[model samples]
Target: MTSTDKYIEMKVPAFILTGLLCGLLLQPVAAQTGPAHNRPNIILIMSDDMGYSDLGCYGSEISTPNLDSLAMTGLRYTRFHNMGHCCPSRAALMTGLYPHQTGLGWMTGTNFHLPGFTDELNEHCVTIAEVLKTAGYATLMAGKWHLSHNIHAGGPQHDWPLQRGFEKFYGILTGAGNYYDPASLCRDNTLITPLNDPEYHPQHFYFTNAITDNAVRFMQERPKDKPFFMYVAYTTAHWPMQAPEEAIEKYKGKYDAGWDVLRRQRFEREKALGVIDKDATLSPSDTHPWAEEKDKAAMARRMETYAAMITIMDQGIGKIVDELKKEGIFDNTVIVFLQDNGGNAEGTGFGGPEGETRPVVPKNAAALKPLGKDEVQYAINPPVTRDGKRVMQGKNVMAGPADTYLAYLKPWGNLSNTPFRKYKNFVYEGGVATPLIIHWPDGIKAERGAVRTQSGHEIDLMPTIAQLAGAKYPSVYKGNEITPVSGISLIPTFEDKPLPPERAIYWSHQANRAMLMGKWKIVSGGILNGPYGKWKTYVSLPWQLYDMENDRSEMRDLSAEHPDIVKKMAAMWDKWAHSTNVYPMPWKEVKPPLRPDYMSTPWEYPDF
Candidate 1:
C-alpha cells in the first residue's frame, strides 16, 4: 500500500476523536495540529588521535579555554571508547555496528589480517548521513574519510562522501598526511590544490584550518529552516607533529617535568574532578625503562608539537562553535566531540616506512643532519634517577623541513593517556579510551559542566543520531538485509539517569582481538593465524579485570584471584570471535586473499 494510504488508514480513529473535540470546543482541527517536524540540527566534531586528557576540560595543562567552556556546558563521558584505531572506529560509528560488521575488522592495506578494506563499508550498511538525508536533513562532512583509499587512485569513483550521503565533502581521504601539505585532500571528489608552494595560501593551508574553513562555508550556505547534520572530522593531534608556530610556541617548555610527573598529575586531577573513580589506580608504565630514558628530550618536544596540534584544532573548533552560536543554532544543535581513536604510540621519531608515502628520514642525511636526520624529533621522557636527574635524553628541535621529525616524544604520549595503559593501536585502555563531550542545550540538562559515568562506543553514534532525528533505520540496503543496528540510544544518559546495562562490545584489527563483557575485558594479540592457530598467549601479558565501578583506570587486574571469571570471559570472547568470522589471516606472510565476487551474489534493489 502507498504511504499516504497507510497514514490515512491509521488516522481514521484520530480524525474521529479530533472531530468530536472540535464539535465540543467549536475549534478547527488544524488550529491544534503540531508542527510537522522538530528534529534538531546535529554537529559531530571528531578529532584524530586526541588523548583522553588532551582538552583543557580533560585536565590538560594546555590552554583550551573554548573546549574547556564546551566541557563545562556539555556532558562529559568518562569511560567512552573508540574502536582502538581510526578507520575501524569511523566505520563502526558510521554503521552503528561492530567494525567487523562493517567489514573493516582491521586496518586498510595488505599486511593486516583484513586486507583491501574497500569492502569495509558495503552498500548493505546505511550510513548515519543516508538515514538523516532521507529524513530531509542537509548533510555536510569535513575531514578524514579513510574508509577507502581507492579515492586516491585518481578516477571518477562513486563511493566517496557525496556518494555515501554527504551533500558536501572536504579534507583528506587517507589516514595521516602532512598537515601543511595534505596529500589526499579533496574538495568533493576533486583533488584540492596542494600547499606545496611556500608562497601559496600560507596561513590558510594547514589541513585542520582548511577543513574548518570549508565546514564554516558549508554551514553558512545551508538553509536555516532545514535541519543539518555535519560531521567535522579534524586531522589534528595525529602525527607528522606539525602545527602553527604560534600554537607550538605556546606549549614550549611546558613538559620539562616529563611523562612520569605529568601522568601522575593528570591522574590526580582526574580523580579530584570525578572524571574517573577517585580510588582507581594508575596503570604501570608499559614502555621499557631504558627506551624511556634514552628519549626524554625528543619526547618532550614531541609532546610540545602534539599539544600545539590539539590547541590549533581546538581553536578551529571554537570558530565553528562560535559561528553556530552567532547563527542562533547553538542551542538547538546537538554537538558531539570525540576522537577517532586514542593517542597514538606509533613511532613518530625514529622514522621508517611507517606508512608515510615519503621516507620519514631525509634523503641526504649529511645535507640535513643539522636538522636531524634518522632521529624522530619528538622523544618520550624516561625515568629519573634517585638524585632527580633527567633520563631519556635527546636534542629538542623540530624534525621536518617545513614541520618537525618531529614526533611527540614518548613521555608526553604516555602522559597523554593519563591513567590508561598503552597508547593508540593497542586494545588497552590507552588505545580505546577517548574523551567524549556531548553538548545539546535543548535536550541535555545535567549542568554546566556535568560529569556522566556512561559507557559509550563508536557504534552508538548512528543509533543515537537516528533517535534524535526520528528516522527509522533501513533494515535492507541495496536489496540485502544489512546487519541490524547494534547500538542503543544514549538519550537516557543525557537525562542524568544511570547508564544502562551493557551486554558486550568487541573489537579486532589485524590479529588483535579485544572483548569487554561488563567490567571484565579479554584482549589478546599475538602472532598466530586463524581460530585454531597455535596460540602463545601472554601469561605475563596480564589478563585484566576491573571493577570499573571502583577502578576506572584499569590499573588493578583481579584476574589472578578471579580465575573463574577470567575463564568465563575468555570463553565468551572465543565464542564471539568464531561466530563473527574473526579468524586471523596471515596476510602479511602470504599472497592476497581472493576478492569476493559480488556479481556471484543476488542483487538487491537500490533504495538507500
Candidate 2:
C-alpha cells in the first residue's frame, strides 16, 4: 500500500495522526535520512523595542557591522512591519496569526477574563516551533518570552517555550527587566537566578551576551540528525537601558548634536543608502530643541547609553554568526534579523522617576557605578523591588549606571525611527515598521544587497519559515483543532516577486487601529487625550486614509479625498476585528486611567 493509504488505515490517536500523516505525505524535500546539505537550519533573531532605523544597514549611527554584513549578503525589507507592540508582535511571529487570534491582542498581564486578552497563548494556535518539530526539526529558543502572564506567580507553564514545542529554552519570561539582573529567568521550565545573582562570585553579567552564549551552546549540542530552528530574542535597546561601562564609554560623545540634528543626519544617510526615498521628508521633532535643553550633558549621556546597548547586542550577534560558521552551518542556515516593535516613547522625552527610596549607598558613591548595583528604580509606583528592597524611582539619577533605570524616551525614540512619524504603540509607520534582514547563502539565490519594498508583517514569518523548511501546518495538535496559518509564505519575495495582489493586513492596540489593503491604508484612534486618551472604543474615531505606496511615512491624509474607499476599508477592518476576536477593546471592560508613564513594566499599569 502507498504510504498515504497505510497512514490512513492506521488507528492512531487524532493528535498523533496529524503528525504521522505529515510525515508520510509531506516529507521535507531535505529528508532527515537525506544529505545534510539539503535541509537548511533556521535562525530567527529579534531585538526588543528597536526602531526601524537602529541598525547600521538600516541607517543608524550605531555600530552593527554583523547585522549590516548579513543584510549585504542577503535581502533587506524596507516595508516590513511588527504588530506595534511587544507581546502582540511576538504572538503573531510565533503563531502565524493575528495577536487577538492567539489570545494576545494586549500585553500578557491580568487576563481580565476576556476572549482576546487571556494573557497567555491559546492552544488553538500552533507555534512555528510546534509545526516545525512535526517535520523532524529540532526546536530551540532563548531570550525574552513575554507570551505568558504572572510567570512568577505560577503562570501557565504550558504556554512557555518548551510546552509550545521548543525542546530547549532559556531566558526571561517577562516583558521587560534589568539586563544585569533579569527576573524570572528559566531553563527548560526550571526557574533560575541570573548569573549576576549576589551569591555568584564576580557578579558581572549582561543579559544580551548571556542569551547569545546560550544560543551558541544550543547549536553546539543540537542533534546532527535533524536540522534546527532557533529563535534568539534579545531585550537590548529596551527600557532600563543598561550596558557594560566600557561599552557605554565607546559612544560617550556620539550624540552631542542632539536628536534634531541626529534625526536629520540619519534621514540623509537612509536616503543615501536607498532605504528611504530621497524625497522622504523628516517628521517634525516633537521634542524640545537640543540647544535649549538645560541638561544637554545628561541627554547626550542617555543617547550614548542607548547606542552602547545596541552595539553590545550587535557584538553578541557577531558571536552567534561566528558560532554558525564554526559549526559549518553558515552557508546552509537561514538567519532572519528583525525587531519586535518601533522605538518606544514611554516615560515622555525624559524618563520619569521610580519613587523615593533609602539610599543603598552614599549618593555620590561613584560617577559610574556598576549596573544592577544601586538598585535604583523608575516608573514603579510602589517603589519596591522583587526582594522588597525599597528603592528610589525616577529620573533624579542619571542613566547608564546599573543603579539608574531610565529609558532613552521620546526625543531619541523619534530619532531612532528616523523619517517615520510617532513611536511604539501606535499604528503609524514609525510604530509598526521595522527592519527585516534575511540571509541564506545556500537558499536565497537573489541578488545580494537587494532591497525589497513589498509590505510584510511578523505574521508572515512562521509561514515563510514553514515553506522553506517544508513543514506542514497541522490541522490538529495535541487533540485540539489548531488555527490554520493566517500568513502567506514570503518565499516568492526571495525570488524578487511581489506580494499577492489580494493581500490585506490589520493591526489594533490600545484602540489604535489600522487596515492595509494593497497600497491603501486606513488608520484611526491614536490621539492621546480626552475620552480617546487611551484604549477607547474605535467606533467614534475618525479614520484617515493614505496611499502607502506614495506616502509610506503617512505624511498626507486622503480620507477627505476618498470617502468611499475609507468607508470600505473601515468596514473591512471591523470585519477583521470581529472575526479575529479584537472587538471590545480592553477599555470597554475596564476604564483604567491612562498610564502615568510610558515604560512597559507590569507595575506601571495599575490594572496589572
Candidate 3:
C-alpha cells in the first residue's frame, strides 16, 4: 500500500506499476541461474535377440571392440537379467515397470483384450523419455519401436515415439524386417522411404548404420541448454542374419569346430575373464553333437555371418561414441549397453525353417551372389502362403544373403548362451541373463574394469536413469494416475556399495515363470521340445529351485530338496503376477488385426 501511494504521488499509473512489480517478483527461479551441471546425458543402447556372452568383453569370439572398450572403462553387472524375450524386456526397460504392468505381457502383434496383453504401453505407465522430458531433458529414440501393435497402420500413430515424449525419433516401427530395407521406417511421426531407395545410387543402406547415424545426428542437433536421454535400440544380430561380405569373411573358419567345441571354449573364456565363476559347470548340450552334423561347412558359414552382424553393430557403436566425444559430452554421458534377451533358436541348422528337408544352396553357387546384398525372403514357421499354398521360403538358399532369410538357429543359439541350459523364450539363466555395461566417466569413481555381481533386471534401467538425471517419477501424468516404478536404482552399485539383500525380481513370459528372492531362485520352464524340454503346460509345470549363489548355469534343479522354498517363491511369484496384470495368459487363439500389405513395399513380417 505504501509503494502504491508512492507510485501515485509520482504520477505513475498504480495498476501498471503494480503489474511491473508483480512480474519482477514472479520471475522463474531457473531464469536467474545457469544450466544444470549435475544432470548427465543418458544413452541406453540395447541389442535385439543377442545372447548374454556374445560380446568380446563378455567372453565371445565376436569382434565387439567398442562394447569391450566400454566395459573396460565402465562397470559390468555380471548378473543382469532380461525378461527372457524381446517385447517384454523392452517394455520393462522403457517403463521401469514389469512388462505386464506396461501392457506388453505378450508381444506387440497380439491384443487379447487382457490387462497385460494390450500390445501397447498402457496409460498407467510412464516411459523413461516421458519422465526425463518433464525434467527438461531432450529425449530421443532411434532403432526399433516395437512397443505398439498398429505401427504399420496409416495416420499419426497414437503410441509412436514422438507421442511417447521423444523429441526426435528415427527407426523401424515394427519388431523386425530386412536390414537393407526395413519396414515402417520413420522419422519422428512420419513414415519415410529407406535411405537406400532407388533414387540413391550405390545404396549403402544398413539398419545398424542408419540407426547409429540418426543417433549421432540427434546428439549434434540437440539443444545445448538441456541434457538428453537417448535410447539406441539396435536390431542387429537378431534374425535374417545378414552382414557385409567383408565382415563375414573376417570370421571365416572361426567356428569350423562347431557348437560342441565352441560352447566349451566360450565357457572356459568366460571363467578366465571372471564374467562367470570358475566353479560354474557347463550344462550338457541338448543340441546334436558337432560330429553328428552333416553340413559342417554351412553351419560354420552361418556362425561367421552372425559374428559379422555383431561386428558391424560394434562399428556403429564406435561411430556413436566418436560423436559423443566430438560433442564434448562423453565424459558426462551415461552409456548403458545391454542385450534384449538370449540368442534365438528359431530356424534349422541349414539356413531355413526347422525340420525342413529342402536342400540348401552352397555358398559357391554362381547364382547365389553375395550374401547381405540381395533381397531374400523365406517362410519360417507354418511355412505357407496366405491362401494355404505351400511356399518354398526356406528352400535351397544359403543364409547371409539378402535373398536368403535364415536364423543361426538352435545349434548356434546353444553356443551363444554358453554354459547356460536354454535359449530365448525360457525362464532359465540362458534365456534371461544378459550383460549390462554402464559407463559414466564422471559419475562412477569405482575401479575401472570391475564387475558388479549383484542381480539386476531390465526394469532397473528407468529408475537408474531417473536417479542419475535427477528426474522425478510423477504419481499422475497427463490426467492419468501412473503406476509406481517397479525397479530399484543401481546407483549404490556404481560406487561399489552393496545392493539391498531383500530385493526380489520376477519374470513371466508365455507361461514361463521365475522369481529371485535373495540368492534363491525358482524357475519353471525350459526348451519347448525334445527329451530335455520340461516346458509343457503353462499353469501346471513343476517349479525348480536353484541356489543362484552356487549354480548360476542352472544345471541342478533343487525343487524336491527345497520344497518349502519353492512353495514360498511360487506364492510370491503368483502374488506379483496378479498385482502386475500378468494373469489370463494369452495362450488361446487371438486373431490380431489385419497387417497392412507392406511386402510389396520394403516391409516384411517379423520372425518372432
Candidate 4:
C-alpha cells in the first residue's frame, strides 16, 4: 500500500484514557550525563509575518546585516518551508509533529470544540524545550507565546509557556497586538505592564527590543554550568508597524521606487545570491502598477516603517550574538533563524478614504488623559494607551508611532514575497517558503555560506535540535504518551549533503492544502469568506500541480497535464490529513455556503 492508501497511525491517543490514567504518576525526567561542550547551546530565533525574500541575503532591500552575516558564516536552506499561518507554524516548530497533531491546527484566538483546533498545546505532544530539559539543558523563551487561548489574567495556566516547557517566559500570550502596549504580556507566568515590570526598565518600551533584551538577559544569567536552549520569537513587522524614529529614518525614501521596481530588484538579487535558481523566471507580480497609485508617498512610508522594524530586530539579533561571543559560547551555540509564515496580506491600515492624510486625533482621546503605566493590557486592539492616546488606524495614518497602528498593507506585502505568488494563509510557495539560516560554529561541517536547496519544514526544527542536544525524544512524558516526530532532522544537510529525494513535505492551513514530493507539488486554496463566524472552505477551486524543480515559484499549473500525479499526491495528502486530525476540517463538520462549479469535488476531498 502507498502513503495514499490510509491515514497515518493514530498518534497521541494510541493508549486508552491517556489524560485521566496518567495523573500524578508522572516522574520527572533524569538529567543527561553527557559532557556540556558536546551538547551545544541552541538558539532558535523566529520572526512573525515575514516573507520569503525579506532578508538582505534572501533578496529584500531591507537592512539585515546581522542575519545576513549569519548566512555568510553558516548555512542557508533555499527550499525550506513553514506552516502557512502563525500559530500552526509555532506549533510545528515547537513539536516535531505537524500542527494538528500537536493540537493547534488554527489560531489560538478561537476554539471550535474540535480535537485539532483546541487553541492550546495538548498534553499529547511535548515541546522541544520539554525534550531538551530531559537532557539537562536549561530552557528559556522570550517573545510571543501564542499557543494557548486562555489569555485572561486569571485563566487556566496549563498551556502557558512556563507550564508547557520554558523555565522563563516573556512576551504576549495571544497573537497580534499593539507593539507599544501589547495585551497578554507576561513575565515568567506573571502578567505585568511594560512600564510596571520590576525586572526590566528601558528608557522606552518597544516590544521587539523588550523581547530581544530579555532573551539576552536570560542567556547571560542562565546557569553557566548548564547548556541552554533559547527561543526568541519576534513579532516585529507583523502588524501595527511601530519602530523607533531613528530606525525608521534609515529607509525614508528607499521604497519610493515602488513595488514593481522593488520586485524586480529583489528577484535579481535572489538569483545573484543563488537563493533561487538562475533560470527561474520571476513570478508575475500580483501588485498593481505603482505609477497609478494616488498616495505613493504614504505607500512608500508604510514600507519604510516596515523595514525599520526588521532592522531593529536585526540589531537585536546582533546584540544576542554579541552576548554569546562575550560569554565565550558563540562557537558552541547553534543559532537557527526562520519565520513563522510568509508576508501577511491583512489590510490593517487600508480601509478608509484613500490618498493619505492624517486627521487630528479624536476629541475623546484628549478628554480622558490617564497614564496607562499601572494598567495591565487587556485589549488586543488597544483603544488608547501610553497616556490614554487613541490608537489610530487609517490609510492616511502613517505607520511609525506609539499611538498609530497600520500594516504595510497588501501591495507592499506582495513585494516582501518577491518572486513568489501569494501571501500568508495560502499554501502556495509564496505563503510557505521562508529563508532558513542555521549557524553552528563548532558543529556545522557545511562550507561557510553554503546554500542547501533540499526542502525542510518547521517541523524539522525540533528533531534537529534534539539530535544536536543528544536529547531523548520521550516515549511518555508527564504521564502522557508523546506523538512520534513527524519530521526528520536536517543534521545530515548541515554537512552540505542532501535529503532523501522522495521525501514529502506537507502543509494545511485554513482550507488550503499542499504536498511537495520529489520535484512535484499539488496544492489548492480558497478565498476569505467575507467576515468572522464563517468557515474557510476550498469549494471554490480544484487541485493544481506544479513541477517544483522547474517552477518552484509555482508559475505554471501542471494539473491538467499530469492528472495522475495530482491524484497520487492528493491521495497521499488525504491519508496524512485524516491521520493527523486535519480531516473533517472545520468546513466539513459545518454547512458553509458552497461555490457551485467546484462543489462536487470538495466534499469528496474536503481540504485542510
| Best by the lDDT measure | 4
Model 3 CA deviation exceeding 4 Å by range: 1-35, 153-156, 195-202, 348-396, 526-539, 588-608
| Candidate 2 residue spans exceeding 4 A from truth | 1-37, 153-155, 195-203, 348-393, 526-540, 589-608
lDDT for model 4 comes to: 0.81
Clashes by residue pair, model 2: 353-393, 353-394, 354-378, 354-379, 354-393, 354-394, 355-393, 371-402, 372-402
Error in Å for residue 196 of model 3: 7.7
Model 2 lDDT vs. the true structure?
Answer: 0.77
Position 408, candidate 2: lDDT: 82
Ranking by TM-score: 4, 2, 3, 1
TM-scores for all candidates: the values are 0.79, 0.85, 0.83, 0.90
Arranged by lDDT with the best first, the candidates are 4, 2, 3, 1
**TM-score for candidate 1, residues paired by index:** 0.79
Off by over 4 Å in 4: 1-34, 353-371, 528-530, 536-540, 589-608
Between the candidate structures 1 and 2, which one is better when assessed by lDDT? 2
lDDT for model 3, please.
0.76
Residue 345's C-alpha lDDT in candidate 2? 87
- The sequence of per-residue lDDT tens digits that candidate 2 reaches over residues 231-261 is 9999988887677888889997899888888
Q: What are the Cα lDDT values of the candidates?
A: 0.66, 0.77, 0.76, 0.81
Residue 241 lDDT (model 2): 68
